[model samples]
Target: MFAGCIDIGGTFTDLILYERGKGLEIMKSPTTPGEFERGFMDVLALAAKSRGLSLGDFLVKLELLVHGTTVSTNALVEGKVAAAGLLCNAGHPDILTLREAPRKRAFLTKIDYPEPYIPRKFTCEVRGRIDAMGNEIEPLVEADVVAAAKHLKTCNVAAVAVSLLWSIVNPKHELRVREILQEELPGIPVTLSHELNPVPREYRRTISTAINASLYPIVGAYVSKLDQALRAAGYKNELLIANCVGGMMPPDEIIARPIYSVMSGPTLAPIAAMQLTTDPNVIVVDMGGTTFDVSALRDRQLVITPEATFGMDMLGIPKIDVRSVGAGGGSIAWVDAGGLIKVGPQSAAAKPGPACYGKGGTEATVTDANVVLGIIDPDYFLGGQMKLDRAKAETAVERFAKKVRLGTVEAAYAIYTTSNHNMIGAVEDITVNEGIDPRDSYLVSGGGATACHIGEMAQILGIKRFMIPRFAAGLSAYGGLISDVRWEEAATLHETHVDFAVERTNALIDRLRARGRAFLDRAGFPRARQRFEYAYQGRYLYQSWDIEVPFTLPGDRLTEADVPRLAAAFHQMHERIYTIKDENDVVEFTTWKVRAVGDTGGADRRGVDLPKQQGAPSPKSRRKVYLGPKQGFLEIPVYQGDGLGSGARIDGPAIIEEPTTTILLLRGQSAVTDAHRNYLVELAG
Candidate 1:
């Protein structure tokens, strides 16, 4: 049997296929945004050919396919989503039009907000009112719902989102509104706030629902088309999709809550680090063609991304905190207006690629800089599957060098260093700014460009060691190989420690667990393999913010004695981070969360090294590389990456060339191959 993972990135589509005893087979293809599903099918075809099996025969033996897609991401960023209408309580249609003020202390009128998802003409008010305590102040008027749905249908709205007052407390009216919408517009998708994100804050929940509903026609269609193709290919398996909440879900769940997939692709690299390494704490850096992202795992849990902006738009979804800087392999390098040199916040993506690719990209990018410096071989690029033009790279850098009064080699060095520093600053924001010392963390670098710069980035920050996997280009896809099916749910209790209701809290948790397990059972996981974790979001009395405290459930029930233990645990956590905690300050709970993971009890995937034992280091050939302006130039040898044996240590001023990546070790640095066929970079004392 076979299982695989596919990740669709901004520039590349990666595939990792795993079979027992045969190990992993990885491949990359250019991402075609015009038809993303076509790119996926193309990769699947390649995987079949590599195994010498026909497409139908290969899929016949496949049991599962896990996919991480950026469809919703591109839809939101490119402003290509479907037109949506909103149906809220009477007189509350203006809630979305009046967006939030700037996060500053005072409101500013000069700020500009993106065009609202639903215009005033498309928003309709229904005759229903529910109070904060789940009481129906005024009964629902069916005629009003019918009128609103009919009006929305006449407007040609593709989807509708139903959000009413106190809907999170009692969703009876919102549920009725959905039924009426289906009755009026039979095929149009409908989203209810309570079904998506049930919380007190209406604005965030409404935005989540609106975004999900708006993308249903687009993302939903693509998913359905892909599912149909898989079945037609003689495949019988579970097709799992990656969501923004750090887990994979079924096709039905994705269409219902597509907003959870906004930043899902970038989040997977961290998951790869979590499963690949034995360390409990690690930092994951992914440098792709267009962007570099930094994410951390303190105890194998993705650091919670605070609710904020998405694709320059004010949107909220449960996302992993992934800090990004526009420094990548294709980041453009140029001479600034002040007669200084600068690297990018701009990128030359796949279509026009980098200057070295001879794809009509005139700008000098980090990839171009590497080619100009002779670190990236023109003839051996991509294992000679594709060739690059060294002349084009030099010409692109020469233009910038002339404007900055420097030589081509000097200009290329500047571009490389500038991009590395840019990534360093991004790493600092996640580590130093968050009160965590970066030196205490192990670094794992992923993506194509990481091999060239991750070592230097870590060394500059006083870091001692870093590791890069052999298949760095497709690390996120490899992460999907080890990922399990996970689902999360949150409910608001808003209870003070002294007056909290333990029985009510227990009942709430029981409901959330049942809801989570139903899907796992449907997915074929037995009750023995299902596990759930419990956590609480708490705050000090009268405080504006809260912190999450995790606790183990004492057998399915939370007892009265557990309250004091929970209070003490919260205080200790607060004190450990903030240096002070008030025992007398009443603590309050805001939300309860449950995360359930259904284990697949998968294949034996714990091996460290490849089946082909690492052989002795063998040099392929030599190249004249510009080590630095200080050293001028050196005729150093380049080694074929696959020929290097484990425990083989190569000193600085050398290069290791692989099919998907390249590693450059500067003077005073060394590279060692671990037993796992990964490289560990160490700085000279």
Candidate 2:
């Protein structure tokens, strides 16, 4: 049998095919912007061609297929999401519009406030009231709900969201309103705040519902079409989609709440890095065509943020803390108004791509600059499947060179250095700013463009050790194939350590455990293959915000004696985060959570390791590359990566050309091939 994984990124679509005995094969195709499904089908066709089988025959042999897409995120970034209407409580209709506080700098006198996800003009208020204790203070007015539905119908809204005041406490009003809306506006999708996010915060719950409703129609139609196509191609099993919470879910489970798919593909990089090295502390950098994403695994554990910002709004969803910047292979380089060259916060994406691609793009990008400097071999790109136009690349860079009054080679060098600077800042934000030193962490490179710049990035950050996987180009897609099934369940339980209600908390945990177990069972995991993790969000008695504290409770219940242990853990964490601890203060717990994890057990890859061999590899050719202005162009040896065996060592300045990626070594850096044929770079002191 066989299994496969596909990831549709902004610039390329990557596919990885895994067979029982043949191991893995990866392929990539340029992403088709408005027709993402076309790019997806194209990759599958490539996989089929490689196997010398018809598309249908190839798909029929596969037992599983996992997908990751950027459709939902792209729609939100371009403001192309569906036009959705909001139904709010009469007195609190402005909850979505009111700003919590300015997110920008405090010293700025004038700042632009972000527009709400749903405009105020589309908001309709119905008479209803629910108190904090799950009590209905005022009766829900059905007539007003019907009137609001008619108003939304006249507006031709594609979807509707119901977010009433205190809906999490008493969802009766929200549920009733949904029924009336369904009856009046038939077939329109509706999202209830309580059903999606049953937490205490009013604005967070309300906005989360609005965003979900807005994404429902777009993501729903996309997955439906893809599912139908897969079925027609002879795929018999369920289609799994990657979620931003570092796991996968079926299309049916995620189509209703597509907000979880915003940053899906980037979350899997850390999981793949863990498998690439034995180091517990790893800094993963994914440099794709349009973006450079940085994520970390500390002590072999993923650091998940309860809330992450998308565009200008904060989403109340669990996400791996990934820091991204517009520094990639296709990042456009331009001269700023201050008469200085600057590399991107803007990208060429896939439609036009870089000038070297010969796709009608006129802008000079990072890839074009690399070509102009002779760093990238035009004839060897994509193993000669796609030839890069070096003359066009020089013409593109010359345009920027004239504006800056510099030579063409100097301008290209500037763009290269500027791009590296942007990527270095991103790594610092996730490492040094967070108190985790980069010098102690092993930097693992991913994406097609990673190997080109990682050595320079590592040198700049003072990192001593770095790793490049054998299949670094498609790390995220590979992660999807090996990832485990995971689901998290949470409940609101407000309690303090002073008079801890052991029984009540135990009951809440039991309910959460049941929910998690049911989900894992439905996902086809037996009890023996399943495990659970526990944690809670809490704060000091007088604190304004809460921090998540992971704990190990005794047995399946919490006793009075365990309260001090939990308190001590919270104090130590608080001191680590804020540099202070308060043992005298009471600890108040707000949200209890249980995360269920199931092993997939399909991680066998005997073909990945190479037989041990000894001998120095010879250079296939030599090319002149521009190192810097001081040392103009120098001849460097280039070796075919596939011909090199285990324990083979190569020193700088040299290039190792793999079929999918290329590695560059500077004057002081050297690389050695490990047992798995992965390159491990050694930096000079």
Candidate 3:
């Protein structure tokens, strides 16, 4: 069976078709942001036409279809979400307004917090109450639900969010309110807190559910349109979507928990990085059109985080624990009012890409700097598919130089260096600052722009080995094909150390497992094919931050001894994370977590090896390329990446050109093709 994967980035939407025996074929199209489905269908049509097959014919042979999108992230960033109304408990109507007291640091003189997603007028209260013990203290009034629904209809809200107190313990009141609203308002979509996130910490859970509700209708409509268009075009494969947790899930499940895809765009590269390297430890540096994401991978797994803040709330979505910085190939470069040059927090998006792209963008960007400094060949970019206007780039760089009070080349170098520093800082934050030793790990660099800056970044971070995959530009789309179908279930049960009972914990785990199994069964996987992992949020008595400890439980049943064993796992994890642990202190289990994964097959299979290189290498041609400060405009050898074979060695400084990407090797480094034909770049110690 064939599989198709697509990833929509800020600049381009990529499509890859993989046949069981024929390997992979790829296509690229500019993303149409006005209507993303247009771009998506356009690329799918192109892929079908390339193989002389109809969409329906292709789908009949297709086993799966996976996609990664940046829509949710962009909507949140640009404030393009649907109008939403919030329904809170009777006494907590002003929860959104109060927020947290320490919105900004106390010492900051000027700090402006962004506005909340929902306005005061749209936030209404309902007469409902639930005690901390999960018992109903007050009944939900039907009149209140009808009134809230009518008020929301008058406000022209596209969706409604119902977040009542203690909904996690008992969703009875919330369910009744939802039923009343549906009967009253027939068409408006509603998001209940219990359905989205049945976790404690009332404020966080409430805000997260509200945000999900706000985006649900908009995202759901978009997905439906895209799916229908593809189906009409003759595609019938299961349309898989990428999640923020670095896994792929069916579109139905994704629609149910849209919060898991808020950072979908950035999570793909780390998974791709892991696939490209054999090293157990490495730092993944993914530099795309708009941002650079640096993350640490240990034992080939991307670090995961349970808490991440988006817009105005702490979303408890399981996500790749990546650290992001605003440095990219398209980052704008300009001089500020103080005569200091700065790289971006602002980007020139795809509409008017970079200044060198000759689209209407006049602002000098990192791409323009690279063009002016001779780091990039003007006529050879994108395999010459898109010719860059070198003169336009030079003019822009000269103008920026005049404004910044520096020479043309000097200004370009400064911008380049500063951008490198910014990325290096991100790497350090994930490594050195977090107590991870840089020497023990290799650096896996991908994304379209990473090849341009990998050498400098590796040098700054003192990392020795670097691996650049065959299709770095399309790595995320590649990752889509290789990830598993996974989901996480969590619950909060406050049990103090003195009162903790093993029986209670086992019962909670049993319930979660059943819930997980039900979800998997709906997705077409049986109980025998599923895998389970367990963890808990525990802390010392009276401690503020809790540590998440993972453990494996017996398949059929669990006993009392599992509690202390689980506690022991927590202590070990605490020591590993913080470098210290107090074994004498009592541990309190606050929350339990279980992750269920249905494997798609592992990636441990070997790759086809390339033939050994012959005696003498034929020089294609020599081009004047810039290496560094001392060696400016040196004539370097360029080789076609596809022509290189296994055991072939190319000494730097050189450039390896491919249809989709370019790899640059600096002086004092050498590139060797491994058994799999993947380039492994090693530097002198």
Candidate 4:
């Protein structure tokens, strides 16, 4: 049986198919933005064609298919979501409106507050109260809920959100409200805060629930359509959707918690990166057609954020720490009003794509820059399947060059350099700012555009070593194959080392572990293949904010004996992050977390390597490529990457051309192939 994964990105839909004991086949197609389902089908068709099988026949031979989509993300960012109403406790109607202010602008003379995800008019206050410590302070008024439901029905809301005060502690009132709303507005989906986030911070919780509720109709229809399409195409197995926590969830789970699918595609890059190399501390850089994503792994473990934002608001869920910047092959190059050349945060996405695609785009993009500099072969793009227009690319660059008052080549170079700078800054934010030096970390480059700029970016950050996977263009899709079934469950706790609430902590962790295990069990993972990790989000006494500190107890339950050890772990982590720790000070634990993973039998397995060859390989062709202003354009040897065997070496001022990607070696740089045919580039110090 064959297993495959598909990732629908902003500019490209990547597909990777793997057959056990056979090999891997990868394909990429332009994304169909008007209907993402079409793009999904298009890539499957391409993969089917490559395998020389009918679409239905090929799908029937597959045992599994994992998908990572951007439908929820696109809907949230574009405000094209369903009309969802928010229901909160009486007198707290401003929970969504009075969002937290920017800390940097706290002392400003005037502050312009950002609008909430949901409009204030859609917010309805319900008569209910649940005080702290799981006590019902006031009885829930069912009349209020029914009235709100009728009002929302008149407003034509597709979904409703319930976020009463203290719902995380006592969810009876919230649950009752949901029941009442369902009776009043039949078939309308309702989201309860305690079930979605189940943590503190009202604004964050409410907004996250509201967002999830709003996305219900949109993501529900999307998943249903895709599932029906796959079933119609002759696939019979379960359809797993990638989630933000580096795991795949079933369609029903994703539709229930659509918020987890927001950054799902980018989250898989680190998973693929960790598998590509044995390095414990590694950084993965994925430069796709629309965004550059950076993620890091420490001790071969993913770094997950306790609270990550999807777009501008707090997601309030555990997420893999993948930072993304709008710098990619499709990033537009333009002259700003100040007469400065700026590369994008705005992309010529898939439709009009880069000007070189000859798709009616006139703006010069990063792809155009590479084309103008001869870094990308116009005729050989996509293995000559799709021809790029060199003249159109040059014309596009000339348009921007006139505004910047520089030659076409100079303008293109400026655009490329600026885009690289933006990518470097994003990498720094995740590494340097976190006290993890990029220089000491091994870099793995993925995505279609990464290989072209990895060497230069590595040199800029003083990184000595990096590798490009043989199938770098579809790395994220590849991740879905190796990724394990995973889920996270967390709950808020109030405990301190001084008091050491042992029984309470033990009870909380026990409940969390049970839930996590049940989740894996339901997903068909046996207990023998299940793994659980324990962590606590805490801070020093009197601190305003908290940090997550992972810890291990001596046994399944927490005891007073483990207090000193747990405190030490918190102190050590605190020192590592802030460069300061006070052992004497009390450490307070606020939230308890548990992560469960189900082994998939693919993560640790090594790929079959190609046979080694004795001598240096010959170049298939030569091209005039621009090295820089000083070196101008040099005739560089260009070799077909697939024709090169393992242990083959290519010297500086060369290009290794693959069907979907290109690797450029500048002056004083060289690359060697490993047993797996990966390009291991050694930067010149």
For each candidate, the alpha-carbon lDDT, in order, equals: 0.81, 0.85, 0.77, 0.86
Q: How big is the positional error of residue 86 in model 3, measured in Å on the Cα after superposition?
A: 1.1
How do the residues 229-296 of candidate 4 rate in per-residue lDDT, one tens digit apiece? Answer: 99999998878899998988888889998988988998999999877889999999899988999999
- lDDT, candidate 4, at 297: 91
Q: For candidate 3, lDDT tens digit of each residue in 292-398?
A: 87877776656776666664556645578877777888888877888888888688767798888898888888888888877777787766767889888888888
Off by over 4 Å in 3: 52-60, 100-107, 496-500, 526-528, 602-608, 615-619
- Give the residue spans of candidate 2 off by over 4 A: 106-109, 605-607
Residue-pair clashes per prediction, in order, are 0, 0, 2, 0
Best of the two (1, 4) by TM-score: 4
lDDT of 3 at 535: 73
Per-residue lDDT for 1-685 in model 1, tens only? 7888899876778888888766776777877778888888778888898889998898888777889988887798778999999988888887776655426325555666656666889888888789989999998988999998889888999999888888878889999888888988998889999878876766777777788888888889989998998888876888998877677888887877788777778888888888767777788999988889899997776777536465434565557788888888988987677877778878887768888889798999999999988888888877787799999999999988888888889999889989999999989988887788889888898998888887678778877777788778888888777777878887777787788789999999998888888878876789998989887878799886677777889798988988888888789767745668999989898878887888754335433464443555667888888867778779987888877667887777788987888988777777887766687877766
Better of 3 and 4 by lDDT: 4
Residue 78, model 1: lDDT of 74
TM-score of each: 0.93, 0.96, 0.94, 0.96
How do the residues 1-685 of candidate 2 rate in per-residue lDDT, one tens digit apiece? 7787898876889987788876777789889999888899899889889889998998888788888888888887788999999998888777776735526545876656778878888899888698888899989999999988888898889999998887766789999998888899999999998887777777778888888899999999999999998888877876788888777877887898898788788888887787778898899998899899999987787877765776667776657888889998999998778987788879998979999999998999999998988888999997778899999999999998998888999999999989998999999988888787899999888888888788778888998789887778888887788777777787788899988899999999998899889988888889999888898888999787778888996688898999998889899878856779999999999888888877775456423666665667899999999988888999999989888888888888888988778888888888888876788988644
- Which 10 consecutive residues of model 2 have the lowest summed lDDT? 601-610
